[model samples]
Target chain A: MKPFDRLTTSACALPLASIDTDQLIPARFMKRSRADGYGQFLLHDMRFDETGAPRPDFPLNADAAKRAEVLVTRRNFGAGSSREAAVYALVDFGFRCVIAPSFGDIFASNAVNNGLLPAKVSEADAEEILGLIETTGAAVTVDLHDCLIRFGNRNYSFTIDPIWQTKLLNGWDDLDLTLSLSGDIGRFEQRDQAERPWARLPDRPD
Target chain B: MTATRQPQTLFDKVWDAHVVTRREDGAELLFIDRHLVHEGSFHAFNKLKEKRAKVRRPDLTIGVADHYVPTRTRALSEVAPDIAGMIRQLDDNCRANAIRMFGFDDPRQGIVHVIGPEQGLTLPGLTMVCGDSHTSTHGAFGALAFGIGASEVAHVLLTQTLWQKRPKRMRITVDGATAPGITAKDIALSIIARIGADGAQGHAIEYAGSAIRALTMEGRLTLCNLSIESGARCGMIAPDETTFAYVRGRPLAPAGDVLDGAIAAWRELTSDADAAFDRAVLLDGKDIAPTVTWGISPEDALPIGASVPDPAAMDDASRASHVREALDYMGLAPGQALDTIRIDRVFIGSCTNSRIEDLRAAASVLAGRTARVPGLVSPGSHLVKQQAEQEGLDRIFIAAGLDWVGPGCSMCVGMNGDLVPSGERCASTTNRNFKGRQGPGARTHLMSPAMVAAAAIAGHLTDVRPLLRSAS
Candidate 1:
């Protein structure tokens, strides 16, 4: 994971709400591991037709959206499925961050893990940003340090969990963070193991 | 007794109990009591291998081959190459990690969510995690269960602790008595319809009131299984006598005094009378009909008798356009009668509605009846199948001209070979109705098992109430 501070790039406005993970990266494409970059399979059902030709009218397939690094969408973006492949698809497709009124809790967590910022602004602010992006094909700037997005002449602030902000900015490994809390975790395990003998983990040879 | 209310919700009680430590960023390191694994967990295993890390608590974790395994009882080699590899990978990874795996041929093999509760692996007052979204289904046992991503899976594998931001608490009270044919799936769908997809976002919902309390364990599972569809991280029902009895004799459950102690502890897991909720909602359970999704969105659902919603009727321009797009993609016309819509296929399985009870509900309808269209009946687990067989549910299904397949997530996710062909319409018991969820250009009408069984026999989206009433 790479540290992300700020980025100014063209924004792709997908106004539809509840763009679920299944639509983001369908289950068919989940067969392969992450090595087989999911860029092509991103929104496969929506992006292309049965003939393998791209849906020309779809936002991502549009001429102007080709270079979009920031995805601005409506509420509840990535609303279904816990497939991290959804995040992989977005990142693999060169998106630095996704701006939405809200995001699926799991999808937002996966986004931060992959160094992809899921900036959440108000619904009205999101619509305004989408409108600005539509009126002017200008780039949208997202500053993680300030939690603010600038598009056209307007600037909109977003809220993210402070911890997620640190992770996105510093590219912190969640595993490492857990490892750092090993002392407390160990103690909890010791007490838990003693208290709930039935809940004790079964023995396994290392 | 004039006392200040020190109210705490069920989520707070369970979450606070499991907190290992709080991080600087306000995220807490919560201990995971039980971790369920499936074929989708292979990527996390690979990452663990890459990092050369040992699973910290292999005993707490259990793996099963479900997502990619065929529900047709076919040999592994005969399955799709990619899918076979995933199943094989799950077995190999579990073996390497010294974790117990319920493979395809194992009698205990089933959907991760199904097997967990049936085997008593999903206990009350436990903080459970799985790599699949439907892990929320285990919350029916009063466990603080939620799904985690592959990377989080690796983290949990390496350390039995997960860092999570505390979610807001919500209570969804379904009031009134449910109608005869109104299954848990209908109540869940009706709730999502009332509240848009994001209605529960960032909240851990506690389902309560008379209607929810009346549901069977299987029905509770069915309701919680669709929590993710409503954008809730997890949905839970506090453990009661019903929940206690269900967990009492399961194979993995505690016995005797240990069980007594567990029950006593679980009894305290309910929300306090004066508990403050971030959000509280109410819905009439009796009002829920044999609902079905007519559009790409699960929230775009209506009663079986209602016509497809016209985009022109939508007040919001953006929302109206979305309706138009879903109608176009679904090849459905506005104002079209939902029951008149023909379905090419019917699927009656998935974590949402594949339990023994679900099968029995469908079987009761399909008995002495024949399916007008191709229909597949995949049980949730081997136990469910065995129980169904013992009760002649399989005979009923076969007699009704439906295929009684093996246990696994079959057409629900379509990672396996089962899928509705392109440009085909299907009445599915699955939770998701997203575009192409069952297959490319496939239109899925999410419904309850009874409704699916009714549609399968009718060859269209029929109102199941009349059929159910007639059968009784």
Candidate 2:
């Protein structure tokens, strides 16, 4: 792993409420295999012009925002269907953390499970951090140890669920969780099968 | 601790009763009754094969190959390479096991959810599971359905069971007749706008009332399909005559006595007039406008003539943050009128609104009119594609210069080899408008299928009510 990493990138703020998964990574890009390069397609609809030129009007085209590692998004940041492609795009694009006031339930989990830090801060804090980053090219530092985030000279406060916090901190997904309990699970299965013969997998006696 | 249950809501009753075992940490083990599998579930099948496990109920398990099957052709041997592989895997997996499968060549071939309802495989008072999220669409017919992962799919295939924590129940009621041009998509979007997407988080939403019941089965399906967008496990409407009528005469639907008993049981599945919910939200049909999702998420939506919500106007931290970022990504300034925005292409299809009704709605708009911009109309399933041909809807689409392609979830996520080219802005019917939902660098503006057609004709975000009025 990258250690208990702390990254402070200029915040590229998108000030629209409710960003759906499509805008993160459109469906056309989802055709290619995960290894075939989808990150380059991120925001294709908005970032490029008819001739595929970078839309100068796009915030992503702004030189300062181009290198941003922190994506400051609007409320309901990951709404709509639970497409993991959205997370894949963001993660692959070098966006290590996303700061939004609110996030979609499934999207938040999807992001967290993919090792992206999805933080919920107050709108004021979110705006302030965004403002600081955009105006001053300020950096935001995420400290997993204290469950806190810092932007510029000020410390921003937010709450992430402890369970998800632990998961993100440890980069553990459901399979990891199950595997961690393999010992107890194995014992439980053995004893249960011995006592109740019908519960074992495959249902065929060895 | 029984809370005087009198005519409890299906959402409430089903939720509470499903709690098999509760852990102190707020998760629970839920009992699953029916498991729905699809083409994508071949991975799960392979995983189970590695373990050499057998599916629990060959009957309870149902598989379909909607994702990879091409709607244009019946010959499976000649499909696109990527899609053909998935089709072959699904067939091989389903045949090797005793599970029932709806193969691509079957007359019932279509999207798993579409076929599930069409074949009457979806019924009231049953908990259904699938490997895809929109499993909630079955809830439109009063079934409790949710999505699971590949591993979970394997677990269900092996054991015919899954673990789930019971969610709180919420009821959203719509009263009165809808104004012309206002569709189920508009209603669902309006509710999301009011609740901020996460309003129904951790809750199972039961859609009830006159407007919900008045909808066609397809309309109800589109409505229930977006429940996950609102962060709910499912959205449901009680099984009424409308539900039964749609299920009748299907290949696998229960017949005669079986159907009669099923209907009788469904009659008792509704929430009594006295039923209450953890949360109740009421909307008048007249208040709903021709809605379209303006930003990335489904919740980030507005009526046809409405202006984008000004981020500066929001007081809530989360709401404000979303407004700003979504606007920035959308390239739409705050308070900008959504109708004024120009569009380069229009897409009409996907799981959300790719049924026959959706096609008809688009065809009605595109009839005798050439789209000012590039346009595409993709159906949800092969059956829908065939039904449209029988009704000549495909002719109208083709005459209008819109690509009339086969079914198979085309352009929804670009999984089946259909995609919107990068760097293009599209008015689309499929759910989500994330940065590149249509393709890498593709910008999507989520809207109803009719709206997509309207956008195609005008070459921008245009209102459909006037077009509808003119059509008549």
Candidate 2 vs. truth: CA RMSD?
6.3
What DockQ does each prediction reach against the true complex? 0.69, 0.20
DockQ of 1: 0.69
lDDT of 1 by residue, B39-122 (tens): 888789889989898999888989888898898755987777778888888888888888977888788899999999998898
The lDDT leader among the candidates is 1
TM-scores across all candidates? 0.97, 0.77
Candidate 2's displacement at residue A173, Å, is 8.8
lDDT tens readout by residue for model 2, B199-280:
8876889998899989999999999988887778688898888887886676566667667766776777788788767899
State what share of the real interface contacts each candidate retains.
0.75, 0.31
Model 2 spans with C-alpha error above 4 angstroms: A1-78, A83-101, A108-206, B1-3, B16-20, B24-26, B49-52, B71-80, B273-276, B308-337
Each candidate: RMSD:
1.9, 6.3
